[model samples]
Target: MAPDSTPPTNEATAEFRAARDHLLQHRGDIEGARRLPRPEGAYFNWALDWFDPEAHGNDDVALRVVDLAADGEVRAETALSFAALSGRSGQVANWLRGLGVARGDRMLLLLGNQVPLWEVMLAAIKLGAVVIPASTLLSPEDLADRVSRGEVRHVVAESGLTGGFAGIGGDWTRIAVGEPVAGWLSYADSAAVPAPFTPDGPTRADDPLLLYFTSGTTSRPKLVQHTHRSYPVGHLSTMYWIGLRPGDVHLNVSSPGWAKHAWSNFFAPWNAGAEILIVNQPRFAARPLLDAMVRHRVTSFCAPPTVWRMLVLEDLTRWRPPLRELVGAGEPLNPEIIERVQAAWGVTLRDGFGQTETTAQVGNPPGLVVKPGSMGVPLPGYEVTLVDAASGAVVTEPGAEGELCLPLDSTPLGLMTGYQQDPERQAEATAGGFYHTGDVAFRDADGYLTYIGRTDDVFKSSDYRISPFELESVLIEHPQVAEAAVVPSPDPLRLSVPKAYVVLVPGATADAEAARSILEFARGRLAPYKRVRRLEFAELPKTVSGKIRRVELRGRENELHGSGLTGGGESPARGKLEFWEEDFPRD
Candidate 1:
């Protein structure tokens, strides 16, 4: 398909038509129609539009990546003007073309947050190749699975990771960075070629741009596919959410190979023409990251809740940066984390919600009042609804907790095309003309969406429904608690009760006294129905991508406290152990 150079107009395509109707009926009957405005003649082809050598002319500092080493040494600094990056990536594109890398071929990229990563990314995008970004942390077993299941035709990785793909099969072309490998092309050599590329075919807006093998938290990795128009254009909402402006330096703490990386690093900032600032480090250390932000004069920032929680453990008052905005994603941000950061920095931390399948669906947009513990309202282009799981119908009544589903009618540009090669699963997911998020939320009367746990994570105890997020939020408010994850533990009498796994802050001892204090803290904060009856202190299990694995925690609880509450059910009761409603005024 040829690229549509006629420009997007007021005309409503089928996806747009359906999306508009759904939003009008549910979110804003009158104002919804006016909010969704299409772009005119604005092409998101980074190679052709932003990275043109002649277009940029002599402008320096198009992108700058900073590497803060683990040994407290500054490793390298890479700055490429718009002209240089474009020309270098163009040479890489030409080199790849010579090596039989055709347009739309799947290429697996396993590299760190380095200059070559961005260069190769632009080159592949210009050549119209579907990139599968893999983390350098993957083992041979993981590599073989992706190579076999992802239908990859080319392998591009750092020299350190070349041995990890030792026995991977197929006629996959090998391209290595950093060092020479037998039978593999050295990526360093691509720079020596002619620094210009001419495309053989026009690029389509809806062409498949990226193929991601999602981090399998529960099941096998699913290939999540995105079109050129979907991600590059769709992240406009993300730019709006972060309040990113041109020339603003934005740093996002996310690893490569994940969707969040592309969400913040690639499109969101670039969409607003902001400088993408990166702090590349071997191991995560809070002080170095904070110092770099101050040195770079970073204005906007985003991080997963895990990183935020870790940072709060240190003395936040010890460092100050020129930060204007801070945002959290990947997981719901607890109210405690927000409060701590705000108290220290005088800047409120906002939270946004989305999945691997889409960009910022719900977020606390700029100029909006961010409600504590709520993930804010739906993004401008998304028509989000709380649909009843049992009835399979949209729930309009306020305070009704239901599955978070996006209507098919709201054809947001950021949504994935479909799960690659899985029609049956896709059909089940997109049932009833909606893309089911599999997550639950409750929209309050004022229109803010409070995240309930995942559909499988929410459960009932003694006929009372429980939201782990609600309890966990309250748990973190305790001074000693650094992070918390709440889930149902089986009980014979109550059927199930909320159990908490907590990480303590610095100087907080994991003793019976501390546990008791946290229990009392939760008792005062949460209602009787949402009390944390049992508590344990242990490192939370997380996916390789850093998402808390509640599913795994739930399994551990079931194994330990089978079928009911018992005195011996607790796992080495850390800190001071205390129970809610035990000494409280009970009805």
Candidate 2:
């Protein structure tokens, strides 16, 4: 089949294309991109309206997955064109409809970075059903919670993971991919169904489309609800942040089930009509990942700070990648890591800031001056502000820190509808005429937003507010440190003091001398008040999505220093390796 020669003529397609083209035209003009009007339509189905027409008879590659074995050899490779994926997803949709799955049904989709994951996502959208994405790394206990909280009416998982849901009691329909499981419908049956799927009804823009369970870094995960327009159209900002162009090969390092996965893996790249590239390895090794990028000629890349940190540890100059754009998110990236990559690859790693509740609200768009430690200006379509947490007053003074908030008066299309089934929590989050991000930051005179830390993660020492991220950024500069998490430890005089949990690089021993070296390194860089008073050499606790759980470290510190009055408490003799500043000499 040849690609469609004629341009899109439908109303929805015209509206979407006009809006998308405006951003592309003004890719470097931030003010012009912000002035572009958002697409407003009563009825829109992305699968039916935009993707199907754009993909019709198109031979361009839509997705490519490279599977790596234990020894870093390519075991298998799969590439699906836009037209092929459209027809396959349509067939899957038809097959799913045959299994009694209907509009508005909640389906729990658990799979890895396989073709079925993309097929099922598109199928669910075409069927007008709500999709609840689940990671394959989830335990049985985690699956049970999602089953209950998500109110899942159907489940589609790999046959190998069917056992995790065996004990999970639910009335949902089971559909298995890979190999067929007993009592579960086989996804292979979808191939027999014909393409050209028809929708049951027109999809409303405000209808619930996706339910995402956030990675609980501080507390239990919250169910975040997104409407059809929130993510699909909202990710225009994300597309711009990544600097994606049509036919570009983009690889985003993220796990399944996380919102970032959907942000980059699905919506962002697809919105730009770019190919979604994946490097599927059982475990992440920097060399194999770089090899995949080089082989695929990936033009755009996005990964978390952890991956960037690991990549910088390797000989980055050895591989000459054709990457034109690079981005880091999930956490604020340190300047040292970004500088190292720039020195080796001559490509600056741009930082972006967003949450599960929204798309790329703030980012360092292409051709912009990226300030050190700043996550850049607000993306187009978002009205970002810094408001005082205590008084709820907007902070106008430059360099004055406050919680990052987005005004709801003219709410951006990217923001989530709200937390599902939790009206009180939702109300609290969106109170004061703004949607609270729960993260803190300060803007400079030039309007670049520098991330501080999460509201819950920031603490005070001697009445001066302290951002753990500020200290952690300095700690990682030391060659010995691989990863570091900062939390407030109890102190009688100052009420609280900064403590660091450090993970050493390979071959570095976790001993008194190592602790002294790290502490002294930090002391020379950080202020006296922000100095790490206590140090513990242990593996940092991380959420399933790989975010550091600072809350857990704070809890551990509180437990160790009961009543917050114990000045010099005895360290635990067993379990985690621990060290302190007093254990070493001041010099």
**Which structure among the candidates has the greatest TM-score?**
2
Q: lDDT value for candidate 1? A: 0.80
Per-residue lDDT of candidate 1, residues 59-105 (tens digit) = 54557888877965678888776567767888999999988899889
How big is the positional error of residue 543 in model 1, measured in Å on the Cα after superposition? Answer: 0.4
lDDT string for model 2 (1-587, tens) is 34767634478778888888899999888989998678899877888888888898798999999999977899999999999998999999999999999999999999999999999999999999999999888999999999999999999999999999989886889999988799999999989989879888889988889999999998788999998889999999999998999989999999999999999999999998999999988889999999889999999999999989889889999998898999999999999998999999999899999999999999999989888899999998899989999999999999999999999999787999999988988999999999999999999999999999999999999998899999999999999998999998888888988889999888999988898999999999988988998888989899989999998889888887646444455543222576777778764
**Candidate 1 Cα misplacement greater than 4 A, ranges:** 1-34, 39-46, 50-55, 563-587
Give candidate 2's total backbone clashes. 0
**What is candidate 1's CA lDDT for residue 481?**
85
Query: Against the unseen true structure, what C-alpha lDDT does each candidate score?
Result: 0.80, 0.91
